[model samples]
Every structure is written in structure tokens, then in C-alpha cells.
Target chain A: MSSKEVFRPTCIIGLGLIGGSLLRDVAARGATVYGFNRSTSGVRAAIKEGFDVSDDLVATLQRAAADEALIVIAVPMHAVGDILDAIKEHAPNCGFTDVVSVKAEVLRLVKDRGLEAHYVGSHPMAGTADSGWNHSHTGLFKQAAWAIAFDYAVENEDPGKFWIEVFTDVTKLIQLAGAEAIPVEVANHDAAVARVSHLPHVLAEALAVVGDNGGILAQSLAASSFKDGTRVAGTSPALVRQMCETNSAALVDVLDEALILLADARDNLAADPADISYLADAGYRARTRLNARSGAHKNSVSPVKISSRPVLRLKPGAYGWVSTLKQAESLGGRIEVY
Target chain B: MSSKEVFRPTCIIGLGLIGGSLLRDVAARGATVYGFNRSTSGVRAAIKEGFDVSDDLVATLQRAAADEALIVIAVPMHAVGDILDAIKEHAPNCGFTDVVSVKAEVLRLVKDRGLEAHYVGSHPMAGTADSGWNHSHTGLFKQAAWAIAFDYAVENEDPGKFWIEVFTDVTKLIQLAGAEAIPVEVANHDAAVARVSHLPHVLAEALAVVGDNGGILAQSLAASSFKDGTRVAGTSPALVRQMCETNSAALVDVLDEALILLADARDNLAADPADISYLADAGYRARTRLNARSGAHKNSVSPVKISSRPVLRLKPGAYGWVSTLKQAESLGGRIEVY
Candidate 1:
């Protein structure tokens, strides 16, 4: 192990999908992993998945505190404060991080608790509709962007080498788990997530409610587009409620903007049907920019390689050869028949 | 073939994705399919796909007229009128249907052209992002619902046996191509598509525009939810423009409702931060209802089956037997030891 990566005996609290996934992957990557869950059933479920977990919070903390371990709090937004309180009483000096959807609020809570010196706030832009430890997989964070928000107070302060090493090790673990580490400020992270994640959830719920009013005909005729657009609305109500309550500030900002944009689109539809470019232009630009950013549409049609022997099998005519070569080019391939 | 299944020489106009898909699938199913395209390159592409396509509209019409074919107008909304005009001039007595998104407008245009006796408004709720004849596939309409709207004028009158036979044959063809034929009135079909299809497209466009306002951080943080929510936004601007313009009336209704619902959700997020069930309740119900309707969430976990086997190989200890039985049950199977 490197000098920077001395934060061992990694402990993950609340073994839901995210925490369980991290436990599996981090353990697989040679970290000494332990877990604790608030519910007995959750702890048992994690144990069934071949993970070491406990329902006892103090014992879980004491082990981490004595070992100078890194503790990842992966509970929902409402439960984060309780976990932080537990940490403050038992393991305040231990390295701590969190994976809640919101960041600014979490940082604030951590600052208020005076855990800033050993704290980092993180939110992984990843999940599936399924929840619980049973639904978690080791590859949950693979290829997803993991946002890391360092505590602003700690950032400006001259923290000792131990804290710096702990922060560096946490980043290394995230990258090792095959996620792109995107370092962002707590406020910026929350704002970005509100626009991208929380707004979509709210909009999807709204779309579903409005669609339900369209009667049986609309229900029967709903196709792939409708299905994809509202897929996130099928998430658990408790989870959705927690997210909405905790991140209401940033979510309300995006929701207000979306409502105005949607209303203007309706107005534009009536005013200038010929050029409803107000919606189309930005939509097209944003969509294309996202596609380019994600490389979603790149090289969908792969090239087919052909050898000279295959070309020789063609009929000995200029039209046949020219047409064959043109066909190959159209199919996104080249026939190198020398 | 049955007596009522006598329609032949299926003529498909504007050989884009829908028309080309129909041409390929119907031809494979033993129908003589001929195609016409407005563009030379489209005709060439169709020909490359082993379709008999022509850029000559009048000649294509004469061929259909000679064979008494069922002509399908599969063009964009703006071009529907031009094709209907050509159909009126060239093949007035033939069985006709259109695969446009907007049915009410098409029915009105067909009535205005005085071709009610030979027309049926049809919209196949199927497509991909990639358009044109080259991007077409045979299974585009597989398991999709094809909405069919009969002419109200012809419906009020006692349409002859021949018209009924034509409608039956069309439904049979749709079924044969692996799609459910949903018989709906013109107005109902338009309103339904607006709610399920057009409204989602508009909402997706609006979301992309709003997310774009969040700058680079929002773009970077945007993940699967954003991608799925805006999948249809990546559609061609020209196509989106036509759908918005032609179906603006129905779309405007849903847009207005969505705006109010979204604004209310935003308000509720602030006012009733504890529950927000006004939005979440309906969203949950609608999502679950859709999932049940589509058989999407059905059979998520399968039960294991076990056959009776000899237990002679096992040691006669109670602990071993109990442990073996428990282990079997945990693996989603039963211990069937004889």
C-alpha cells in the first residue's frame, strides 16, 4: 500500500443497495470491509450476501474508531443526521464520507457537528429501481460518475498529513471501483443533482399523474417513449418522499424553471406553430450535446471487415465490383480486396 | 387464403422507417409490396433493401390501381395532403390507410378530398431514432399497438361488404405483422396519442432545455435518469417539429395539465415537505398500473422446482439433514429426498 492509503478497516453503515454494493466491491478490491444497518433484517440480509454486518451501532463504531478506519454513511437523507450523531459520540476522529443524493445539507450538518476535519461528502450518480441489500450488486458504481465534495472548512484549514492521506485514499478507492471521480463543491453538487436527478423524478411523477387523467385509451396506447420517460416514477414512495423533503430547495429551483419552460412551449405552440423552435432548438442542442458527452450514439453500426478472397468470389464485372464496394461503404465498412 | 383476405399488391407510400418496415415484413409474409419515395436516394435505398421502389408517383399509383391494392400513406403530417391528393387523382377506388401520428387532421383532410369511402386513418405507434429507408427493420411494429380510426362519414352510412372486407384484411395484416390492432375513433386516437406520445416528446424537449440552463456541472452529473427521460429528444428536429405542429391542439391540452401539475408539485414540496403524497400517490398508482398493464414487473422472481431423489447417500445425523434442507430452501429450491 502507498503512504497516502493508510486508512484501513473500512466500515460501511446502512447496507442498502449502495452501501452493500460498496462493501462487495471494496472487499473484492482487498479492503477490510465491515457493515452495520439500523434494521436487524437489513443486517441479516447483508450477512446472507457473504458480508460481515452488525445491528449494534456502538460496537461498529468502536472497531472503526480504534483502527482509524474510514466510515461511509450510505443511509437516506433523513437518517444521515442520526448516523452522524452516533459517529460524533463514538468515532468523531475517524475518517468519514457519505453517499446521500444531496450534499450541501450534509456538509452543513457535518460542519455543525464539528466533524469537518475528517469528513468528505460524496454522491454517486448511480442506482436502479430495485432497493435493499438483496438487490445490490458489486458492479453498481461501475462506469458511473462519483461526485466528491470536500468540506469547505476543512479545505481552507491546514489539516494534518493524516487527514490528507485519508481524503486521498477515499478518492483512490472510488476510482478503483471503476467510477469516474468528479470533484465538485458541496453547493454546486447539490444544484447539479437537483437539475439532473431530482427535477426528473418530480417531472416524471407529474407526467404520470397527468397521463393517468387521459383515460383508458391513453393507457392502452402508451408506447416506449412514455414508458422510458416515466420509468423513475416507479421508484419507492418512501425513497421519493425522503429525496423530495431533503432536497426540496434545489429541486424547487429546477421545478420552477421547468414549469415556466413548459408553459412557454405551450404558448409558442399556439403562437408560431410553423417555428416552435423555442422548444426544438434547445432540445436538439441539449440532446446532441449529451449524446456527444456520453458517446451513446458513437459507432452504433460497427464496420465489417472483408478479405481479398471474398472480393475474388464476386462476379468479374465492373458494375458488380463497383456496386459491391459501394454497398460495403454504405454498411460502414471497407473491402480491401487488392 | 380466406374469401375476405383477398387484398393484394400492397402499395406503401413514402418509404421511410414505418413504410419500409411494413414493405419488408408484408413482403416476407407473401404479399406483393411496392413502394414509392419522394426522394431519389430514398428510392435507391429501398431498392438496395430488395424493395421495388419508384420515384414516379403516377406510375406507382397506376400499378396499384391496376391491381386494386391497399395503399398506405406513410408520410410525414405535412406531406400527407400531397399523397392524399395523388391518391385521389390516380387511385380513387382503392382501399386506403395512413400511418401518420395525427389522425383527426388526416381524417379531416381525407374528408375534404372526398375520399371517405376508401379511407381509414391508421397510426402505428412504433419507430426508432434513426429514420430513412436505410435505417428500417422488419420487426419495427412487433408487439406494438397499431391504432386504427375508421372514417366517421363511412361509419354513419351502410358501408358495403367490400369495405368491411377491406377493413378485415387490414386488421389481419396488422395482426400478421405481430401488432395489436386497436380500433378507435379519430378524435379519441388523436387525444390519446397526444397524451401518451406527443406530450412526452414535448416534455422531454422542455426538460433538456431546462437542464441545459444548469450549465456544465449539470451536464456532467446528468446520468441514466436524464438520458432515459430525454431519449426521444434525440429525435430529428424536423420530425419533432411536424408532430408538434400537426398535433398541437391535443398536445396543448396535455401541456397545460402537466404545467399545473408540475407547479403544484413544486408548491407541495415546500408546503407539505413531510408527505407530498398528493403527487407521489397518483404517480405510484399510475406507475404500478402501467407496469401491470405491460406485464413489465410480472414474475420478477421465479420459484425453483425440485424432483424427488434418493437420500441414501446422506449420513443419518439430524444436524446434517436439517442443514441440507435449509441450504436447499435458501437456494430457492426444496429438498426432495425420498
Candidate 2:
């Protein structure tokens, strides 16, 4: 291995929102980043914007191989296999990873093709409802979670901690992009995402259908409440469908449970409308707990530990009590009045 | 009929969010708005806030009757019938109305007790997640819809249109409070609300459930996308459940329809996971439609309509053409070169 920092040359395949954003981030961090896009105009625009880009996949891959680069397949989920094939044919020695949301099938494909030695499965959970390169921003990955999958075997060998070193470096880079690296089994990741990500998409789309029967009038009267409620519904129906299909069993299970909960509430309400109070109490308690727990971790300021002793208790009418209490509290001390 | 303008001392039952807001709006507009509360502390707080309030319902009703005023019941759905019965006993001659979301059942109750001649059903489709009198704002109802229900018998007998006159006046006050008068059948109103209002509550609760399951790690990684997606889920569950219970059948219908749509999408995706393009396309289309249609209402700022006229066609190698075109477009015209 040469000491010239083999990670310097990086290739990003695709120039859509996610791909474009990653390219910009990598380039901004002093990496020589090259981009490949099927769209001639996209390639032209990226080049004009000072990126090393090419519309020709073969030419782009040849240049990447010459540089001994790492390649990131940032295409849509369905296009992942084709991109991998292209990488194998053109730049076979390059280390490869992807930023696809779904993993089980894709990881299986990589392993079966004897490409497991260089491939890692990654899912960077960051996006807006917006799409396209035009909507891309370098700050998109800020404070996001990037799940990176690493396997112990490489060509039926231990690889002697080489995979760990690569993953650690990748994790550090992800952290610099303001994302945390979470390691989990591909199946577990899919199930977890099916619950939080895919299920909401399906539910949101389903809720949006209410407007379909009511016509545009119903949708027009929809305030921020309805918009926020069905925001995920406005997500790409195709993507939502893909997510549901990819993680069908787990998504179906979650959906079934949600439906049961809703149905039970409806039945109880029919029996006695006031019984809706119980559902509301349950929801309130759940939301309050979520908010409190989330808030506890949200202090951006670094935590500091201090040891202190309470010296006195002041009565309401005690002289100099207000000033003393304020001073003590300001120093992060707990105060109680007797 | 008396020629002297009589000050109608209004009794607002249940001094909570809506009732308190109405009291503030009416009082500020020079109407004598008297509030009643079951909680003595609530009554005391209202009085402390300079409101004419009482813990005694009978006293408040008597005060309104003495001034030949209207009684506005502003309690939760379950409490409306009892409050109306109390008002009938103490202030039978005074006109009455209510500010409850669901109305058909309550309207039936009012008519069954022969109080329909004095009572009208009103549902103001406006509120915040926060409750209590302290959260009341006089401008809360501005630009919202207030549905007013009228009876044909009273208008046909006297032909004086007294109820209509009072309702029109109240509607004007509602308009002043920043709401529009939407005359609707109580059943139709409930159905419409089920689609637009009640359904959102169910969706919010569902989102809260997703957040709950995601736990601390998931919540920590939850960004603006998650926040926006679940914003409505943070609304008071009790109020939401009240809405759901009161309009259970309609909500259940909507929920069922929503689930079916979701199921269909899920199945479609399961059949073809490779077609994620459709999902992205649907999302793009929905977002585009939302953006285009958002400000098309009367209350919102009118969107700038782009003209299709190619007044001046741009020629190649035209220096400063882009800037000139931008300026021309900003001034509501197009620029092109022949």
C-alpha cells in the first residue's frame, strides 16, 4: 500500500439530490471528487459548476480506476445493481459503498457476486420531500444517521482488521458531515426503518385519500394541521410503495397493529363518545413522554458535572432571599424554600 | 319591540379555550360577556383577568335573562346537554347558541327539550393545541369558519327573521373575530370535519405512536423531516379524542378509506419494487401541486401568475440578457429576442 493517502480520489455515481450533495461535501473537504450522470445536461451543468464529471460511464470509471479511488454508488435503490455491475466491469479494484435506504436484497446481491471484499452497505437517513440536483444542498446530511454495514469476511479471509479501519475512517467522515454512524444487522435496520420510515409513508398516503373523495375543496380547507398530519402522504407514492414492498412483512405487521389501535378507539367511542377521552389520554401520555425524553438529549451545549451543597432554606418573607436564590440557581444549584 | 338598544348580557358557559377566546373577543367589541365555570379557581382567574365571570351557573343565566341577552354554551361535547338544560330552567326567554365542534346530537337534544326556538348550533372551526383561558386570544377566530345552524319553524311562524337577524349579527362579530360564516347542515358539517379535522387527529396520534416506538436513539436522529411529519401528533390528545369520539362513524369511514389506499400502494410496491420512479414522481407532483395551490385562497397573498407570452426571444451571445430578463419578469412581463 502506498502512503499517498489512497482515499484522495473519490467517485460519486449519479448527480441527483443525494449524489450531488455528497459530491459537494466531499469536494468541499479537499477531495478530488468525480461525478457520473446519465443525463448529458446534468453532467454538463456539474462540470460547469467545477466538478470533475462525465456523461460517459466507461470514461468516468476508467479515470476513477487510474486514480485508485473509492466509489460511492448514490443512485436510486432500484438502479443499485446496474451501478454495481458497471463498477465491477470498469473499476474492479475500487472500494465501494452505497447510500441506499433498503439493504437486505442489495447486500445479498453484492455478496453473491463475490464483490463482498470491497463493498459496504450504507443508508444515510437524511432528506427533504424535495428531489433533483437543483434542490440539493451540501448541508443535507447535518446531524443525520448513516447506518454502515460491515461484514467480518472478505474473500473467506479475516482481512486482519482492514475492514474495521475503513469503516472507522468512514464513520469519522460521516460525523464530519454531521451524521452519526449506526451499525446494525441489515435485517434489523430494514425492520426498524419499516416501522418509522415506511409505515408513516403508507399511512400519510392513505390519509391523503380522504381528500380524493372530498375533491379539492376538502384539500383547500386543510390547514397546517392537515398538511403536517399528512406530510408523509405527499411523499413519492412510488417510493412509499417500494418501501412497503421491500419490507412487506414487517410493515404489514406494524400497519396491522396501528389499525387495531384505531379500530378499538373507534369501537369504544361508538359505545360512548366520551370514552374518546381514554384514547386522548393515551396519546397525550405517549407524546409527553416522547417530548420529555427527546428534550433531555437535545442540549447542544456540552454537559458539565459539578458538586455543590445547599447552605440554606429561605422563607418567602426572608430578607435578601430573592437575590440569594437567583444567585444560587444561576450557578446550577437546586433551591428549596421552607 | 323596544326602540332603545338593549345591551344583551351574554353568558358564556365553560371558560376554557374557545369560550374564553369568545369572551375576550366579545368584551373587547363592547359586549357584556359574562363567563361561567364549574371550577371556582377558573372563575376566580377569569375575574382576576378583568372578566365578568361567576362560578354560579344560575346567577350567570339570570344576569343574561335580566338583560334579554343570549347564552353561549362553550363547554366540551359531553357537557353541552347538561349546560343547555340548566340554561333552559334559569333563562328560558334568552336566545342561546353553542360553540361545540359536533352539533347534530346536541341540536337534537336542544329541539327535544323545546329549546330549539331559543337555541342555534354553531361550530367555529378554529383553535390551537393549547387549552385554558390563559391561552385565549381575541384574534384567535380571525379567518376561520363558523358554521351556524338555523330552524325553519321559528322563521316561518313570525316571518320576522329574528333568528336570522341575530345570527347575521353574530356572524359579523365572528368575522370581526377573524372567521368566516359557512352555513352548513349539521350532518354535512360533521362529515366535512371528519375528512379535514378529525382525520388529522387520528394521523397525529399514529405518528406519536411511531415516535414512541422509535425510542431515544431514533428520536435523537429525528430531524426536521420527522418534526414536520409529526408536528400535529403533539396536539392535546384529550381534545383530539373528543373530536374522534364525537364524530366516530365519519372518522372511521375516512380511516378505513385511508388504510385501503395505503394497502393498495403497499401491494403495488410489493409487486414491483424496481419501479421507485413512480413514487418519486408522485411526491414531486403532490409537492408541486401543493406549492402552486397553497396561496390561491382569498385570505392568502395572491400568487404571481407567469405569462406564456414570448414577447422577446433571447439570442445567443447576448451580454447581460439574463439579468435583463430577470428584471423584466419581476415586473410582470416576459423578455424574448426575435
Candidate 3:
């Protein structure tokens, strides 16, 4: 507890892989944590591991309310609404965040429940294909990027001091969990994750199906490439399905784009037999961009704390935070709370 | 030298990753191997590592012919025809095979050169995304599957005793390299690899392109799933392109199927939020099938050598090898060499 001065008590409502891991990570960082899950197995596993865990949702929220802890909903997207309702009933004034993969849907749910004022959206881009408490472990978020929500230009007071503290709390929590919290526009998060995260699951599953269709000889021949390409297909289907459904619009757009690219490659090859150049070129260019990001970040300003600049103080009402978030994102720097 | 009685002298034409690694493995297995490379650096690296390598393809082939060695053409598909022509000139009496990814195209090329009688189609399903001699290492094909082509219901001979020895030579080479040589139909190899290998490359590249399209935020947020899905996109594009082009027909078929699956998932999602169930169900079932194959293999008879059965003796001319290969492939077991 050497860092007691900046310590933020954390309460997680879902002891699945993400939730249980978050609980372990926070506790291991010398911070107080309480976790709840509907499943007896998850609670039992957490308690057996010597972590503070409970099966009663309302009791955990009540404890979080008493300690003024930041409540983190670690349930699947479909379960977010119910979790938010429970938090609102038991921990009405506690500032909250979530570890949901898709953000916009959870944002809407918070808005619907009149809990937006006390809510901060965040997603830890970590975890294995496996789920449940038994699979959870510490250091899951080590060196990973955590996307924390940023608001648009405000119409009212001095950039909303309350919201800044909420962000600070969330980022601090993320830091303790061993990740770089990157500030991002909440509305845009679903679209971005849909392309990079959601679509991959779908693609892996499709690859899996196609490999199976190759029959016996093909199955025996599947090597490292196929294994890597379909690695995510082994993930919990219900989990993947829920995430894609929550971000359906953006996932559809990106899935359509992927389908178009594949079709074009297939058609071109079918017609000319040597037209694989299309996909090969596009893919090479894309890989170059991916490589470039690593180098660009090395030369650019590191945005450990994006607000380190004078943007917050110079603002009349709303700050130019959009530009700041965009800059941090472009630089691919982690936002450090300290 | 412990098992020198079964040793097969190896001559490899091409010192790329696969070829270089094969030289290292075979030599480590106490077999005499001579490797030829177009690049001076490859030959230099192998020589520095105490491997017998040279830059003169003609001289290497001549040596192979003198020793009656098993010549291995381990270059790209587009380079195979030229290598076959060279082998026809200098090693006309030597039996040869290839480590090419596509079997049908190489089979056609060998047939065109009238070298089919002395040529065996083989593909070592190994190597990393990297290429060239520097990236090669020993035991690269350890425990990997190597596919050797079997002719379809042969006619006008007693199952071709020479071909059987050719297969035994190829399988022994694979075994010495620490791999399982799976005998498969040459014509079906292309279609099978198209689904399990070639199409995975295409899909990985497409995923990489889509991830790059997600912009800076998405790029920063790309996690293990995206990385795994797009891992093969980092491969040498020229190599991937050539492999796809060589098997364009089979690739097109499988690629089209993947597109249809993804498009159907997209359309279903667009129509109904709950429609993600289609892909989830199909993917789960496919994964189950993949898992089932492992168990099925454990229960069935193992086929280390397909000709181990009495069918070779019972056949008047054409052997019932199809059923044997099918059983081996279906069970998903590696064909061991005794």
C-alpha cells in the first residue's frame, strides 16, 4: 500500500475471464478490490485464490457504494444493461466503467439508465480465447492497450472538472492493471474495434469452417498458417457472437469490405489465373502501414498523459480534446496516469 | 550413422527457408545432403554452418545423378519448371521430388517434362513467415506433416514397383527430417491445400488490409486476435502470390466459399441483431469436427505405409490404394517410416 495516496478501490461485477483477471491484477497491485459473479464456481474459485469475491451482486455494489469505489462491469455486451440497472439501484452515485469489447452499445445502455454522468467507457484489449474464472490470471493486461472513452466538445462549464476526475480514476485503474489507457471517442470505438477485433473472430470462424470442408486429407495437411489464422475460432462462441451482435453495424461494414476484397481476388484469379497480384499488393501495402506505426510512434511525441499540454486550461468551455485524442492515437502512445 | 542403412542421399535445389532447413535437418540425421542455391549468401551461410552447399545447380545435379540421390526441388512454384528442365538434363536417371506447396501444378510440370516416372510430388508443410537462408534453422520440419503424392488408380503395370520405391525413398527422406510423410493423391492435394494452406494466406492478408483500414486508433488497438489472424500476411508476398497463382482454381473455389460464409453472416446481422447465431453455430460445429478427427485417429488402424496392406499383391494392375490413403488421411495420423 505504498501507493495508498493514489489508490482507487475497484469493484468488478462479473467474475468471468476478464473480470476475475482484473480483480487479481488490481489486488496484486496493492489496491483493494471486490468482485461478484452469478456463478458459484467463479466466486468459489476467486475466494479459493484468496481474493475478495462474492456471489451476491447487490451486496458487492453496496460495498462499492460505501467505499466510493469505481465500479467496473465486466459482463458480456448483452448483460451490460442488467448490470448497469443493478449498479444504478445499489451504487447510484459511484462513477463506473466497463471492460466490454464494444463501447457504443454500453454507452447507450448507460444513457438509457440515466447513468452516463457517472459512467466512463473502457475496454482492455486482452484475454485469451478461453473464458470463465478458472482461466483468469494476473498480468493478462501487461503491455496491452486499454481504450478509455473521451467526450466531445462540451457546451457548458470549464471542460467539466468532474469528468476529468472520472477519466483520471479510470486511467489509474487501467495503469494498475498493467496497460496503457488510450483516450478515444466513445462513439468511434465500436467502429475501430469492429474492424480489428470483432471481424477477426468472424474471419477465424469462417476459416475454420472452410478448413473442415476440406475433408480428411486437408485436415491432416493443416499446418501453422491455418492454425494461426483460425486461432480465435476456438474462443467461446457465445462470447464472440455477443460481441459481433453488439457491434453489428460496424462489423457489417468491415465484413462487407473483407468479402469484397476476397471476391475480387477470387474473381480476378478465376478469370486470369495470375491476378493474385491484387490481394498481394493490397496486403503488402497494409502490412507496410502496420510496420510504419511502430516507427512513427518512436519519433513522435509520447502521450503518456494526453492532458499534459495546456489544452485543458486554455479552453473557454469545451477543449480541443478531439485533436488531442487523435494525436495520441496516431502516435500510438500509452496514456500513463502518473 | 546409427541408421546409415536406411540413409538416402539428398540434393536440394534452392536454399530458401524450406530448402535450407531441409539441408540442415537431413544432414543432422547423418544423411549425405548437397544443396544448391542461386544466392551466394545462402551457400555461404550453409558452408559456414558446416553443411555441404554449392551455387552450381548443374554440378549439384550431376553429383546427385552420380550417387543416385533423391533430388529435391525446393524452390517456388514458378521456378519448378526450370528446375525440372535442369534436372532432366543433368540428373535424368535420378528420382526426384519437390517441397512445393502446390502438388498438382508440379505434377503437371513433371508430366510435361516426361519426368513423371522419376518425379515424386511432395510438400513439406513447414517453415515460418520468414524466407531465405539466414532465417532457416535446424529441425524446422520437426513433427510437421509432409504430403507425398500418390498416383490415381494406376494402369498398365503391377502398381509400379519403381513408384513404390520412389515413395519409400521420399517418405524415408521426410522421416529423416523429423516429419511424418502422409501419402496423398496428387490431384486432390491442390484442392486440399487450397483450403488449409493457400486460402489461409489470402485470408490473413485480407485481415491485415482491413486492420490497416481501421486507421490509427484501430491499429493501436490491434491485439493478439488480430495479430494471429493476420500473421501470415507478413510472409514474402512474391512467394504467397506465386503459390496462390499456381493453385488459382482450387484457391478460387475455397476463397469464394469463405466470402459466401462471411457475406451471409454480414447479411444476417444486418437483417437481425440476433442472427449472429448462424455463424456461431456453424463455427462451433466445425470446431467440433476438427476435434473429433483427433479422437477418431486414436481409434483407427495407423497407416505408416499405405502399401503395408495386402492390396498391392492382390491387384491385377491397379491397386486399391485410394481406400488406404483415404483411411490414413481421414484418421489424421502421420505415416511413420520403420
lDDT by residue (A137-177, candidate 3, tens digit) is 99998767888886532322343665666677888888788
Evaluate fnat for each of the predicted models and list the values in order.
Answer: 0.72, 0.33, 0.78
- lDDT per residue for candidate 3 within B221-285, as digits (tens), equals 88889888887888878988888988988888898898889888988889854478877778777
Task: List model 1 lDDT by residue over A1-338, tens digit each.
Answer: 33454336788998889998898888888768898988899888777767889999999999889877889999988888899999999987788889888887788898888877788777788997678888888888875777766444235544555555566656666766666556666777777888888777877887887777886567767788888888998988778887777778878888888887888788878775445667887898998877775563354454532111111112212234434433432221212222
DockQ of each: 0.29, 0.20, 0.57
Residue A160, model 1: Cα distance from true site in angstroms = 3.3
lDDT of 1 by residue, B33-146 (tens): 898999899898778767788999999998888878889898888888999899999998788888988887888898899887787677888997688888887888876777
Error of 3 at B232 (Å): 0.3
- Angstrom error of the Cα, residue B91, model 1: value is 0.8
Candidate with best TM-score = 3
Instruction: Find the candidate with the highest lDDT and give its number.
Output: 3
Q: Second chain only: TM-score per model?
A: 0.83, 0.79, 0.88
Better of 1 and 2 by lDDT: 1
Interface RMSD of 1: 10.1
Residue lDDT tens for model 2, A231-306: 6655555555555666676666666667666666666655743366655666667677756644634643546422
Candidate 2, residues B1-338, lDDT tens digits: the string is 13443335567889888998988888887766787888887788888889899899888888877877767888887787788788888888777788887777788888788876566677777776778887887878765556655443223444234554455445455554556545445666677678777877776676567656755434434455456555666677666766777778777777676665545554554453423334434444554455455543533444643222223344312454434434433232222232
Question: Of the candidates numbered 1 and 3, which has the greater lDDT value?
Answer: 3
User: Model 1 misses residue A101 by how many Å?
Assistant: 0.5
Worst 10 residues of 1 chain A by lDDT: A305-314
